[model samples]
Target: MIAEYADRVWRGESDDSIVDQGMEGKGVKPIVDGVGWWSGFGNVVAFEGSGELALFDTSSPFSAAQLHADVRAWSSAPLTAAFYSHGHIDHVFGTGPFEESRRATIYAHEAVAARFERYVLTSGYNAVINQRQFQAPGLRWPVEYRHPDVTYRDSLTVRQAGVTFDLFHAKGETDDATVAYVPEHRLLLPGDLFIWVTPNCGNPQKVQRYPREWVHALHRMAALDAEIMLPSHGAPIFGRDRIRQALLETAEWLESLVTQTLDLLNAGARLDEIVHTVTPPEHLADRPYLRARYDEPEFVVRNLWRLYGGWYDGNPANLKPAPDAVLATAVADLAGGAARLADAALDALSRGDERLAGHLAEMAALAAPTDAGVHRVRAQVFSTRAANEQSLMAKGVFTWVSSESSAHANRLGAPE
Candidate 1:
């Protein structure tokens, strides 16, 4: 059944259910002779040999016990070692459950420890962003993390029960991403590097993502000619041809964005101009693995700008911009009143220009902070904007903005 689902997804016949499946805890299913895949918020891949097991990614804390139980159902072998796909809480936290039975060595990139430290330092901030990003209110970020027992800089090779596991580090969704290859089994484990959606290299709320480096990583993975590919977030892909196509196309998609952005930057284009000008490869738009369901291409362009260039977006006024309220009030005064601005926002909405409507609605609300009517319009505009968005990141942010206005309308009570 899982194989059928994966095949459908690979052919673009399936919908977003593939991602939904990844988030639900499921029993371990064999991919090949000795490899088992357990799907959850993060998928866990286990290789059993000689009464011993080696795993790629332990899965999230929420699914830790379930993963351990599921893997145990498949094999009674003691865990020899586990390789972390990255320092993400979901992939590293599940080891604790398996460790209850036997201590297993943990191996990850050298940057994993640094990522853990950063997570600890920004736990509260992480919690708030995640709450907004996932629309999960009151979501708590984990402060403590399981530091890797063994760390390597570029690559490391480990053998467990007659199987050789090769681990390589690359910067993609995170700085500490690990791609594991079992040469004997001809299998590849790409952590969040290939989460079945468009590469999440442009998360608006998170830190900078390495798109250029991510392209390089994907290209390298494509050359491996793996017969089976198990990603940390989604269904496994079988067949060497399918694996290669997915990796290369994904790499090309990211590379296109990076190249376009850099070209504009070199042409002395401003950030706003570059963002509006650069476009993804139209030919690859229909590719199953290249959809922008989680992270859109535009966000990747912005991230690229931040990477190669600095934060200055070439607008001098914005460099030392006035407070939002102050600027809004001045504009409102010039336009006669905040009510006029709100009416203009409605007109923009009527013209099917939500982008313009959003700006005017926000300015009107800021100019008339006490006006519930203005906030009501703000709420409606942002709600429509959220509804039209394709990516989860944009939808979550727009929804949150709409909710903020809705709250103001509720608290202040709309005008008669």
Candidate 2:
């Protein structure tokens, strides 16, 4: 039987799509009796107690204030505990509003501490990665993080007014991933584990992700027969059968991708070959919840190769390859000049051959960064490529290239 009060959730194709089109400071929706979640750039899962409350995650800094205000509308109780699903800045940075005092204990897997440390060391690197990955050249990665008060190695449980939350750790998108289960409600809250998209276990620009362990985590949740499932990024799912099926099928999708990719890796296949080879089962790929809207199966394969192999991609030339400028200069010289290559890029874009267009465009830019005509064509082609892409990572990178090209052109035209 389906839960009649299941949470009404928001499912966005991409984070920018939701953020720009606006879902910020969105109000809470009911999941069960005392459980609900607020939709923003990310979701905050809230559970109300008689005189206290708990929240699974706080959305990013951009919308955390609004999300906190919205959650307060439903529960005026001071937060007794806040759970960090993982160390992602978006999930862990917004607890300041709920910290009525230092008395509030925070829970997370112990692995998060090391992840936080690494993030601190790589703050500038992360900032640049985010700018290129999200197309926001001005954005900065938040350095401040709220460390956990109580951490578990594997799993932990807490009870408040007879409501039991069993928090389990399993690696999916990150090593410190946590999946929460409430026995009384038969509801599951696994932050990014069960987003209603092809699982993002294979982000191209991030650290290693655990697809095999992630599948096992899904299996563990499916075994519980949850009546409702809520993810930090996507809409809530209802009904015991539907929930179980969703969880298991999501597992199947990962298993298929992992198995296929691993076989290729073990066979000594190169990263490029594996990327083009590994494929998820057609049945699992067709599901609405598993669509590759933000991250594709192809990218997942590349990540798998990284986990098992090194960055070499089995190509000796890439071990210490020539700089992009050096290579682009040669290509442009062969093509006659930067202007000719730029025209070829535009022609490729017009013919809808974005892969070829992207190559020619980059060569034109690297060969003649000061040429306004080359910059104009490069910007136009990349902008078009960005619009045509489905995955957020691809779109953001493409848009950044276009934006950079456009800014260069504007800079060249300005009066000295």
Candidate 3:
């Protein structure tokens, strides 16, 4: 059943919802002779070794118990060690459950420890941003983390039960990412490196993503020529040719963005101009792995600009701009009133100019902070914008903004 589902997903016949079904503890199914894969929001791949089991990832806190139970069901052998793909909350939380029987030595990139430290330092901020990002108001950031016991800088090779596991470090979605290769099995565990979506190099609410470094990592993985690939978030890929095409094409997609962005930046173009101009390679648009369902290419362009050029955005007036409210009030007065601005916003929305509508609606609300009528229009503008977007990142942010205005509209009784 999983194989058929995986094939459908690979062919782009299945939607993202199928991949995001939220971990029913699908149980550990055999990948090869001795390896077992437990599919979840965060997949855990267990390797049966000399009277013990080694895991690729431990999964999130929510799925910890189920992950343990499912893996235990597959194998009674105790977990001897585990490899963390990265320090993301989802991939590092399940070890505690397994540690009850016997503590498993964890191995990861050295930067994973620093990532945990930063998570602790910004726990509250992380919680709030994540709540907005995922639309989970009740979401709480985990203060506690399972730090890796063994850390490596570049690469580490571990031989357990006659199986060789080679770990390599790279920066992509996170600063601390580990890509593992098992030679005997001819398997590649890419972690989130190849999540079957457009590389998430442009998360608006999160930290910096290394597109250039990520491209390098993808290229490196492609060169490995692994026959079977198991990603942290998506279905496994079979055959060397299929795996090679996915990895290399993904690398090309990111490299296209990086090259285009750098060309514009080197040409002394403003970020606004560069963002509007730099485009993903047209040839690769139809590739199933290159779709921008989770993170769009435009966001990646913005992230590249921020990486090379500072936050100035090449707009002189924006460098020391007036407060948003102050600017909005001036514009509102020029347009006659805040109601006029709100009307213009609605007109923009009706014309299918959501980008313009968003700007006008925001200015209208800022100009008349207490006007429920303006807030009503603002709500409609953002909700419509949210509906039009494809990527979850844009949808989440737009939906959150709409909800904010919606609360005001409800509280003030909507101008009636």
**How much does candidate 1 score in TM-score?**
0.96
Clash tally, candidates in order:
0, 0, 0
lDDT of 3 by residue, 1-416 (tens): 66666677678787433135432456887888789888887888889878878999888998998998888888888888999999988899998878986888899999998889999999999999988888999999998888888999999998764478899999999889999999998999999998888998899999999999999999899999998898888778888888999999999899999999999899999989988888888998887778787898899999988888878988999999999999999999999999999999999999999999999999999999889999999999999999998888998999999999999998988864
TM-score, predicted candidate 3 vs. hidden true structure = 0.97
Estimate the TM-score for candidate 2. 0.91
The C-alpha stretches of model 3 lying farther than 4 A from their native spots are 16-25
TM-score versus the correct structure, for each prediction: 0.96, 0.91, 0.97
RMSD of 2: 3.3
Please give the CA lDDT of all the candidate structures: 0.88, 0.81, 0.88
Which candidate ranks first by TM-score, i.e. highest? Answer: 3
Candidate 2 has its poorest 10 consecutive residues by lDDT at: 1-10
Q: Which ten residues in a row have the lowest lDDT in candidate 3?
A: 15-24
In candidate 1, which residue pairs clash?
none
**Whole-model lDDT, candidate 2?**
0.81
> How far is 225's C-alpha from truth in model 3 (Å)?
1.0
